[model samples]
Target chain A: MSAINGQSTNGSTAAPGTPRTGGEVVCDAMLAAGVDVIFGMPGGASLPFYDSLYHYQDRIRHVLIRHEQAAGFAANGYARATGKVGVATSTSGPGATNMVTCMANDIMDSVGVVYITGQVARPAIGSDAFQEADVTGISIPITKHSYLVMDVDDLPRVMSEAFHLASTGRPGPVHVDIPKDVFLETTTETAPDQVNLRGYRPSKVGNARMVRKAAEVINAAERPIIMAGHGIDISGAADELMQLATRGSIPVVSTLHGVGTFPETHPLSFGMLGMHGLAYANFSMRQTDCIIGLGTRFDDRAVGKEDEFGPGAKVVHIDIDPAEIGKVLETDVPIVGDLKLTLQKLLPLIESRDRTPWLDQMNGWRRDHPSLKIPDSPDSVLPQEVVRAIYDISGGEARVIADVGQNQMWASQHFWYERPRMFFSAGGLGPMGYALPAAMGVKLADEKQDVWCVTGDGGLLINIQEFNTLAAEGINVKVAVLNNAHLGMIRQWQEFFYEGRYMGAFLDNPDFAKVAQAFGLHGVGTSSRDEMHEAIAMAHEYDGPVVLDLHVDRVENVYPMIVPGTGVNSVIEDPR
Target chain B: MNGTETHTLVATVADHPGVLTRVASLFRRRGFNIASLAVGHSEEPGYSRMTIAVEGSAEEVKQCEKQLYKLVEVVSVRNLTGAPAVTRELAMIKVRVTSNERPGLAEITDIFRGEIVDVSKTSMIVQMTGAQSKIDRFLDVITEYPIEEISRTGVIAIARDDVGPRNGRARG
Candidate 1:
C-alpha cells in the first residue's frame, strides 16, 4: 500500500506532518506513466495544478491552445499518432463545457484520452463562488465514465483509475474533475491502491452462442447482405468480414461510416447505403432477404425511412453497446458484444451455400451502373480519381479514414478495400471535423499501419490546428484534402434545391502548403492527375505529417443522389 | 439582455442540500437570474424535483443543460413544453387597482378563471391556474392597472395521456 509515484504521504506511519497536495500526486502518476505531452488551456480554477505542472517541465511538455476544445483535439491527435493515452486539462464552467464535443468524439471513435478538469473549491461549491462549476455532472453522458475527487488523499487512485478507464475496455475518453481546494490541500493517505475495473475487460472474442447463431444465419440464407460499420474496424474484424462475404458469395454494403469495410471492386459489393447512398446499393439493401448489420447502429442515415428499411429481411445487428440493440430496427437475431470476437466465433457456424446467382445479380447491377470512375486527363483530379490513385498505390489493404461530406461519399464509392476495418469515418453523428483527429487516433493505435485521412477542405479547416500537433508528435500520418474550396455538400444542395443561389457556400482559399510548411511538415498541392501517384508516394516517404491538398472539380456532385422521401431506386446519376 | 425572457426547467437530482446551491451557483456565475425556484420530493424518493424558471434562448437553455450534465447529482433534465405535455402553473397576483375601476375585479376574475383568494377594499388577490401562456396572457391584460406582489409556482408538466408510454420503457 505504498505510494506508487512517491508524491503523496497518505497512509504513512510517519510523524503527523502535513500531506502533499493532490495535484502533486497526479503529476507524479502522470510522470510515472511516461506521458510527455499535455494539450490544454489554463483558467482560474486550474491554477494550482498548472503551478504543479510548472515544476515537472523537464519531464512533461504542455501545449497551450487558443481554445480548450482544440486542446482536446490536439491531445487526441497526439494519442492517435503514438498509441499512448492523450491528455487534456481545462478549468471548470465554459472551459469544461468546451471539451464535451471532443470527449464525445473520442468516445464514439474509440480514442483513448485522459481528460482532467478543475472544479470550484468544496466549501464554495454551491455558494455561487466565482468560476465554480460541477464538472462531473456535465460529462457523464459524453464520457465512458467520470469521477469527482473530493478527498485529496484519493488523488493517486483517481488519476490511476482515469488512465485505466481511458486505455482499457473498448478504449475511450475518461474524465476526472478535481476540486480546487483538493488540488491545493495536503493529504496523508500515501498508500497507493491497485485499480480494479470490475467486469470491464475488452476480450477480442465474441460470445460463443451469438457468434454461432450469426454464422448459422449467414450459412443458411441463400441471398445474404453484409451491412458493415465502424465497429468492424475497432475489433480489427475487417479481414473476417471480407472473407465471409467473399467465400459465402454475399454482397456487402456499407453505411457511411462503414465505407471502406469492403472492396469497391468485389463482385458482391454494393456501394454505400441509405440517404445519399448509391442507388444500386440502397436497392440491394431493400431487395435482400437477409441483412447483417455489423458494428453500425441502424441510424437514420443508414436505415432510411425505418419502417421500409429491410422490408422482408431477416436482420442480425451485432454491436458492443447494448443500448444500440433493438434501438432502431429489431433483429431476428441480436448479438451484443465485440464484433471481432463474434466474427471469430461465427467462423465455425458458417457452411457454404450456393451464392452464384446472387453474385451474378450483384455483378449485373455493377455492370449496369458502375460506381467507380477514374478521371481521364492529367490536369484535373476528381475526388474519386484521387481515391482510386490511393487504392492503386496502396493496394486494397491500407486503412483509410474519410472525413464528412462529399469526400466521404467519393471514398466510399471509389476505394477498393479488400479487407474489413480498413475504412473509418464519423457515421453516427456525421460530425464535420472528424476525419483528421480520428485518423490521428487510429494511427496512434497502430503506428506502422498505413493510415490515410480523406478529408474535404471545409472539414479539414475546422480542426486544421491539429496539423501542428501531428508534427510535434512526429507521427508521419498521410492526409489528402479534397480542396474544392467550397462547402461542397451545401453548395450541391443549393445548386439542386435553391436554383444555384449559392449563399455562403464559397470559401476564401488558404495556402494549405504554407500552413503545412509552418508546421515543419511536407505540404504539396496538386491539380494534375498524373502528379497524384508521385504525391502519394512522396507523402508516405516523409517521416512526419504530410498534407496533399488536391484541387478538384467543384461542380462534380457525388453521384446516385437520391432525394429524401423517395425510394432507394430513385437516383440521378448526373444531376446537372 | 433587456426584457429577459424566463424559462421553466424541470430536473431530477439526488436529494441533497448542496444540489440547490450547485444549481443556483451555476446560473449566478453565468449572469443568469433564476426568477423563481421551487423544489420538493418528486414522484420518486431519493430523488428531488426542482422547477427553475429561467430567462434565455433555446440555445442558452441547451447550454445550461450541458452545464447541468457536468454535475454528478443531476441524473436527468428536460424542458417540457405545452404542445406535448400537460402544463400547469399556479400564480397569486395582487392588483392595486380599485374594485370600482372600469372593467374591474369582477371581469378580471371571470376572464382568468381565478378566484379572489384575498379581498381588500382597494384590491383583490386573483388565484389563476392554467398553462404558462394563459397566466402570461392574464398578467399582460392586467398590467395597465397597478399590481403588487406576484408569486408563481413556475411550470411543471408530464406527457399527455396518449403521447407517453403506458409501460415503463421509453420508445422512440
Candidate 2:
C-alpha cells in the first residue's frame, strides 16, 4: 500500500525505482535496527540471504563460523560483552537444530540474541522436504518468542519485532524462521520505524511504595547481605549496586554470573556464592538477618535447600521480571522494575549505617576459612595454579570467558574482577565448549580488549574446530587449557558420590598445544609449576591466537563444595 | 477431584498460528495440569478468547496466571475462580432404544428441556445445553439405557454482568 521503493519511509535507504528482494528487505531491516555485525554460517536454504549479505559487506560485517553452535555462542558472547542484541543465522534441519542448545543457554543466562533460521519452501514446510524441520515448534518453550514467516510482506515487521522482543524485558533469545522461497520473493515492504505489539510492554519504573518498604526493611536489620546476581550486569546497575552496598553497609555476595558487578576487590565484596562458592560468602549468607536479593533469581545453586537458606531472614527481592520475584523464595518486599531505576529510587531512602560488629564478624570468618589458595607443588602443576598464573601474567586486565566444570570454578575463584562484564561463563545452562567461540565474540565486540578462553581438556575438544576460525579471522584470543587428562568435575563427583568408579569420565586425550599449532596458531605446553608462568606469559604476549596447555594434577578436586541437597552451612572444605 | 481446588482462567490472545500449542506447551512444561480448555474467536478482530480450567493449589494456580502472561501472544489473563461468572457446556447423547423405550426416553428428555435431534429404528440423539452440573446429572440419568455414543464440549465461561469485558480488555 505504501510507495514502491521510493525515498524510504522507514529508516532503510533504498534507491527510488529499484526493486528489492525479500532477502534485501530483511538485511535492510537489520541495518535500520543498528546491527553492524552478524555471526552466521550459510547453507542451501539460506543461500538467498547470503547472496544479499554479499552485496552489503561494506555496511554489515558477517563472521562465517565453523558450526551453527559456535555462531549461536559467538552471538551470545557478543550480546553479553556489549549489552547489545546479538544476531545469528543458520539453515534448516541440522543447522537450525545445532543452535537449540545455545538458544537454551541464552534463555537461562538472560542474554539477548536473535536467531534467524531458513526453512524449506512454503509448500514443502509440512511435507517433510529435504532439510525441513519444525524449528519454530521445537523452540517454542526455549525462545521468548518465534515466527515462521510465510508471506514476504511480513518480513520487515517480523524482523523488527524479533529484535525488540529479544533485547527488552528479561532479555532472551527470539527466533525467526523464513522459508527459502520467501527469501527470493520480490517485495517492496519497508521496515517499521517502531514496533506495535499490543500485548508486549516491559515495566521499567519501580513502585514508590514498595521501594520505601524495602528501604525500611534494610534499615532496621542488624546484619543485611546483598545477594547480587546477573541482572546487575545486564541492567548496567553496578554503580548503583556499589552505592547501595556502601550506603547501607551491607556485605555483597555475587552469583556466578554476577562475578564482576560489585568489583570483587572491594572491601565489602564477598566472593561468588554457590555450590563451589567460597565458604566465607556462604557463611555470611547463613548468618545474615536480612537478605536483599538484587537483580537475581535466587537460583537453586545460589540458594541451596531453599527452605533452609537464609533461615529466619526477611527477604527483599528486586528484579525486572515479575515472575522471578516470588518464583523460588518468599519475599517481604517485592519490587518489579528495572534494577538500575529501582536502585535509584531506593538509594535516597536508605539510611547510612555502619554495622561494625557485622563487618568484624564477616572478616573473622574470612580469616578462619581461607579459600582459593594455590598449593605449592615442586614437580606437578595444580589447576588452581594455572588460573592464578593467568591472572598474574595478564595483571588482572583480560576478560576471562570460562568453560564449564572444574576449570570454570578455579577461574572464578582465582581471577579478581574489578569491573563489570570482565568475567563471562555459562552460569545457568552450564554448557561445555562455550569459552573458545564466545571469546571470539567478545574480542570482536572490542578488538583492543584482551580476551582469554579458559577451558578444560574435555571441553576444548568439543569445539576444537573453532581454532581454525580464530586463525582465519585473525582474532587474538588467548586460550588456556587446564589439561588434567580427565573430566575433572565429573571425576570429582564420581569420587565423592559414586565410590570412585570413574565411569566414562577419564579422557584419553591429544596434545592441545600441537592441535593449536596445526591450526596455524602459536602453541605452548607446560607440565610443571616452573613452566606455567612462562607459558601463560607467552600466550598473553603473542600477537596472534595462541594456546597454552598446562598439564595439572589429575586428581585435584574443587573445595568448599556444598554437597547436593544440602545447605551452605554444610560446606565441605579441603581437609588438608 | 483429589480435593485440590480448580481455578478457571480467561485469557485473550492473538489469533495466530501455533498459539494453542504455545499455551498448552507452557502448561505442560511448567508442570501444571489442565483440566479443560475451550477457545474460539472473540468479539474483537484478530483475537481469540480461551477459558482454561486448571487443577492446582491456590499458590500453583496463581503461578499459572503469571506464567501464562509471559507468552508474548497472550494479551491478558484473568483468574475467574471465585468471581461472579456464568459457565455452560453442550452435550449430544445418542442412546440405543427400541420403539417401546421411545416414550419413556422422550418423557425424561422433556423434563430436562432437551430436544431429540435425530431418531432411527435403533437409536435416538438428544441435544442438551446447560451448566456442567446439569449436563452431568442428565448423563447420570440416561446411563441406565443402552447409550451408543456421547460427546461434550468443555466448559466456556464469562464474567457475569458488567464485572469485566467479555473480550478481556483491561478496564480503564
Candidate 3:
C-alpha cells in the first residue's frame, strides 16, 4: 500500500503520547472511515461523546432521532441505500437496548451497519450504576462482532476495526460499547492509519476451482433460474448479474431482498419468488433444472416447504460468507467471495446459450397470472391500486420504501424498480414502522434522490413519532399511507384460513390527515381512486415532507399467495 | 445415536480474553450436548488447544466444526470421530467395607491396575487412570460392593501420533 500524499505509510504521525480525549480519538477514527453523518441521540452516559461530536461539527454532522431504534433503522437505511457502512449511536441502558431489534434486522439481512454505544464507567460496569447496561454482552448474538472498549488507547483501533469488519466479507452489524470514563480520559497516542488483525482478515477472492465448477454447472443447466439476493446490491453487482442473465439467456427470479438487483422490466426477469410470490415464479422454482442462488441464504420464506423444494434442480450458491453456502440447501457448487468479483470472473466462463422453452413456460405464467395492477375505475381504491399509482406517478424512479405487512407486499408486487438501491424494505426481520425513519436516513444519505415511503396504517403507528423527526430535519420524503381499517395481512389470513374469524385483527385508525397536521406537515386523506392520484401528485409537488393517507379496500388480500405448510408451487392465484 | 455415543473434538483457538466464552457460547447456542471439555496451553505461543467430548448427530457434529471455524478466535476445529485416537480418564472411588472384604478390594484394584490411595476403618479410596471404557468396566465391578462415592474426570483425547495436522491453513 502506498501513501496518499506526503503522509508516511508507517502510520502514527501523531506524537507517541500526545494526550487527546478518547472521544476525540473516536471522532478522528470516524472521519478516517469517511463518515459524514451519524444518527444517534445523546443521553447521560453518552453525553461526553456527544459533546466531542459538537467540536467535530465541521467534519461530521450528527442527526438526532426521536428514538434509538429509529436511529438504528435510519443507519440501516443509510447503509442499504448508499452501499456504505451505516452508523448509529446511543447512550447506555435503555438507549442501547432500544437498538436491539434493528441490530438483529441488519444481521439477518447481512447489512453492514456500525453502532457506537456508551457504557457506564469501567469500575461501575457490573455494579448496576445509573444508565449502565451489558450492551456488548447483549449485542454479541446479534452482531457480526462486538467490542467493549477497555482502554482509551484502544478506541481508535476499535473504531477502525469496527468499520473494517462491518463493511468486509459477509457484511453485518458490529457494536462498540465504550465506557463513559474512557471517553473523558486523554491519551497522546496518534491513531494508526491502517488496522492489521492477524486473526480477523476476510478472504475476498473466490476459489478458482469452485468458480470453474459453478460455471460448468451453469453451462449444463437446461432450465436454469438465476436467483439473486441483496448481495448483488451490497457488492454493486447488478450489472454483472444482468451480464450473466443476458449472456446465457437465463431467467431471473429474486428473493424479496433481491427485488431491484435486476430490472423487473427485463425480458428475463420473473420478479420475486417464494411465499406471496408470483404464481409463475413459484412454478419456475419447481420446474427449473438448475437453481443459481447468488448472495441469497435460501431463507425459509424464500424456499417454502423445504421438503419439496427443488427436487431435481442442481443448486449453485455463491456468497461472500461461507457459512451460508450449504446451511439451508444441499448445494452442488459453492463459491465464496465478494459477489461482484466472483461474478466478474465467472462471467467469462459462461457460455451463451438459448433456453427458449423455459422462457416460453415462464412467459405463459407471466401472462396467465400477472402481478395485480390498479383498476382503471376512478371511484374504487385498493391497497394494490395505491402502490401501482405511486409506481406510475413516480415513473419507477423514486427510491421506494415499504413498512412490513399488507402494504409491503402490495408495494413489492406493484412497483417495478429499474435499478439497485432503488427499493428498501424490512425483508429479513420485517419490522413494522421501518419506512418512516429508514426513508429519512435514505433521504439524508442522498438529499437529491426522491424517497417515497409506502406504509400501512398499522405499520405507520408503530413509529409514528418519527414524523416529527422528518419535519424537524426538513427532509422532504413523501409518506404514502395505504390505510386499511385492519392488520390486512393477518386479516387476509383469517379470512382465508380461519373462516373470517376476525380476532384481534381489526384496527381503529385515527384521522391520519389530522395527525400529519399536528406534526406540522401537509396531510391529505382520500378514499376514492381519483383523489388518490391527486393526493400522490400534490404530495410529490410539495417542497417538504407530506403524508397522503389512502383509505384502501378493507379486505384485499395479496394474490399469488403460498399458504403456509404447502409447496412453493401450491400458490393460490386469487383468494375468495 | 441414542444421543449417548461419545465423540472427540479438537480445536485451536487464539489465546485471548473471551475466546472461551465465544466458543462455549456457540456450543450452547447450537444445542450441542458437551459431555466434557479440557483446555490447555498448546505448542504455539498465542494459541490454546481444547479437547471436547460431545454426543450428537453427524450433522450436528459437522455444524459444530463449521460454526467454530466461523468464530474469529477459533483457528480451526476437527472432529476425531472414527479415526484412531488415544482416549483417557482419571477417577477416584471411595468404597465402604469391613476388614474381611478389604483383601477382596485390594485384589480388585490390582486386577484393574489401580491403587488404594487412602484407607480407613470404614472406607478405602482407589485412584485409577485408563481408557474411558476401561474405567467404566472398572466402575461396573467396584460398584457391586458398598461404595461411598466416586469422581471421574471427563474424557480427553489426542489424535494418533502418526497423523499430521489435517489442514495446514489452520495452523496459524
Candidate 4:
C-alpha cells in the first residue's frame, strides 16, 4: 500500500485503518507508556505528531499552551506536583529553543519531564532549511539524555529510552528530536516494556553499615537536627522522615522547595533554613551538634557560607544521587540511597532522647528574631500582610505555587503549609514567571483542589500570557500579585549592595488587575489592609480564575536576610 | 591546550551510534581539547574502548573524569599518561623520491620497521606503525625531501597492569 504522509510508505499496518507512521507509533507508545496528558503547541515541523494526537484525544489530553516555554514549565510543574512523568511537545527551531530554560531549570531541580520536539527532515537537516535546528546540540547540556532520531526504525526504542532515562535514577528532563520525515514514515517496531541499561543502575537502597553509623551519630549527639529537602516528597518518604524525626527528639528544618514535606505546623519543625530562612531556623542549624541532611543537595542558597551555617556540626548526608553526596558541605557519613528506603532502615536503630536545652535555645532565638508581623504602615501594605491574608482566606487548605523573587520569599516566610506537596516552586533555578502556569498544572491534577499562584508584578509579567491557558481550560486558580512598582528583589539588593544605585531596578507601573481582566479573569486591585482582606475573600469565592493585585511597599526587603559574603548565622533581622 | 601537556584518557564505553557523539560532546562541553582520539572494539562484547589524548591541567582532568562518569554508557576510565604503557600510531607517507635516494630511504625504513608498500618512479608510500615519538622522528627524516602527503591514525595506548591499581581497578 502507498502512503502520502510526507514520505514514501513501507506499508506498516499497526492497526485497522492506521498506516502506522512513526508519529502514530510515538503517540501510541506514549499512551502505552502511561502518559495521560501532554502540554504542547502546533507548528509546521510538528504537524505529523499533532495530527497523530487528534486520533488519541480520548486517551490523552493535550494542553495547548500559548508559548512553548509555558508548555515545558507546565509539564515540569505537573511532574513535580504529581509523581508521574510529564511530557512536553514542540516543533523544531524556535519552538525547541524556547524550552531550553525550562529544561535547564528542570534538571537543576531534578524534575522528570520528557520533551519531544520535531526536527527538519533528514535530507534538509544541515542545509539551513526552514524550521530546522540542531535540537540535540542545544539540549545536551540541559537534558539528562537527548536524541536525534535519524532513522524511522529507531523511534520506538528512542521513545522508550527517553521515558526511562527521564524518570529513572536522579530524574530530570530528557529530549528526543525526531526529523519530520521520520515522524511521517511508517514503522512496525514496538516500544519495549522492560529496559536493560547496564551502565545506568542507580543504588536505591542505603548501605546498612552507613545507616547504622548515622544512627549512632544521631543518638550520641544531644542537638542533632533533621534537614529535609524536596526529595522526601519525590520519593514519598515524608511519613518515614516524620517517623524518624519523631522517634528522636530532633528538630526538622526544611529546605526552600521542601516547605510542606514535613508539616510546618508540627511541633518539632524549625520552619525553613537557608539564606532568607527563618532566623530561629538558621539559629537551630548553627547551634546543632549533628546535622542529618536528608535528600538535599545542600545548595548555597539553602546553607549560606557553609563555614558557619552548621558550625561545629558533624553532617551525615543522605541522598540518592552519588554526585551530590559531598558536592558541597563536608559530610562525616555519606549514605547514598532513596530517602524512603534509607530512613526506613535507619529509623529502627535510632534511640529517643530528651534535648530540652536545644529546644529551649531554639525558642530563645525565635523570641529574639520573631516571625514577620503585619507592620503598622499606613502608606504602604507590607508583603507579609498579603501572605497572612491569603493564609487566612485559604485556611492553609490550598497548595501554594510561589514565583521567584520577592513574592516567593514572602510566601515562604509567612504562609503555612500543613501537608506534603503543598508548595512547589523553581527553587534551584529561581526562574521568574513560573507560578502562574505551575499553579494551572497543579490545578489540573485535581480540578476541585484550591490552588494559589503568589507572584510579584515582575514575575507575573514574565508569564502573563498564561492567563489565556487558565481561562481557556476553565481552570479556577487563584492568583495573588504583590505589586511593588519595582523589581523588588533586585531593588533590595541594590539598596543594600550598590549604594542605592537603582539603575534598571525600577519596574514601570502596570495595573495587573486590568491585564488580568483583559485575559478574561476576574481582577481585583487593593491598597489598604481592609481592601486586601476583602479582595482575597472575593478571589476565594469567585467561580473561575481570579487575579488579586495587592499594592505593597516598594522598598521593603525580605528580612532575616543573610548579607552576601556573610556567615549564615550573621542574619540581619528587621529594625527592632 | 591551555599551557598544559597532553595526557591520554582510556575509557570503556558502550558501542553504538550516539556513544561517540556523547564522548566528543562531553569533551567539548567540559572545555578540553582532544588532541588525538582513536576508538575501537574492546575485549568485552557490546562495549568499545576509547584512547583519547586530551590537553588540560590536572585539576581540569579530575573535573572531566567526574563529568565523563556521569555519562550513562561510560563504564570505566583510566589516566595512562604517566603510567607504564605502550602507544602506537600507523602512518602512510607518500614522499617524492629519486632512484639515488632509494638506498638511504631503505636504510631509514629498516631502522623504523617500515615497509615500502607502494613505489613509483617519482614517489613511494612507506607504511610505518610505532610509538608516537618514533613516527615523529621518521616524519622528520622524510620531510627533508619534497613530501607529497601523509596520513596517520591517532595514538592508542594500553597501560601495563603491573604498574598501578591492578585487577580492573580504575579511578573515577
Q: Best by lDDT, which number?
A: 2
- Tell me the spans in candidate 4 whose CA falls farther than 4 Å from its real position: A1-19, B1-9, B16-21, B24-38, B43-46, B52-63, B78-172
Residue-level lDDT of model 4, residues B38-91, one tens digit each, is 999999999999998888876567656666777878878888888888888889
Winner of 1 and 3 under DockQ:
3
- Highest TM-score: which candidate? 2
Candidate 1 per-residue lDDT, tens place, A1-576, comes to: 222222232222224344667777777667655567787888888989999899878877776665677677656655644556788899988888888888878876666788889888888887878876666666666676677788887777667767765764456788888888888988765444355433233344556777777777777787788998867655668788877776777888887767666766666667788777766677676678888998887777667676566677888888776546675776878876777767767755677667888777766776776545453544566778888777777776567888888888887767766655567665554677777766765666567788888999999888787787678776567999899889899899899889999999887989887789888878998887767778988876666789998888876687777766665656666432
Alpha-carbon deviation at A416 in model 1, angstroms: 3.3
Better of 1 and 3 by TM-score: 3
Going through the candidates in order, their DockQ values are 0.04, 0.78, 0.41, 0.33
lDDT of 4 by residue, A454-541 (tens): 9989999898999899888878899999999888999999998999999898889688888888988898898888888898888888
Candidate 4's DockQ is 0.33
Total clashing pairs for each candidate? 23, 0, 4, 0
Query: Is 1 or 2 the stronger prediction by lDDT?
Result: 2
- As a whole number from 0 to 100, the lDDT of residue A245 in candidate 2 is 94
Q: How well is candidate 2 docked (DockQ)?
A: 0.78
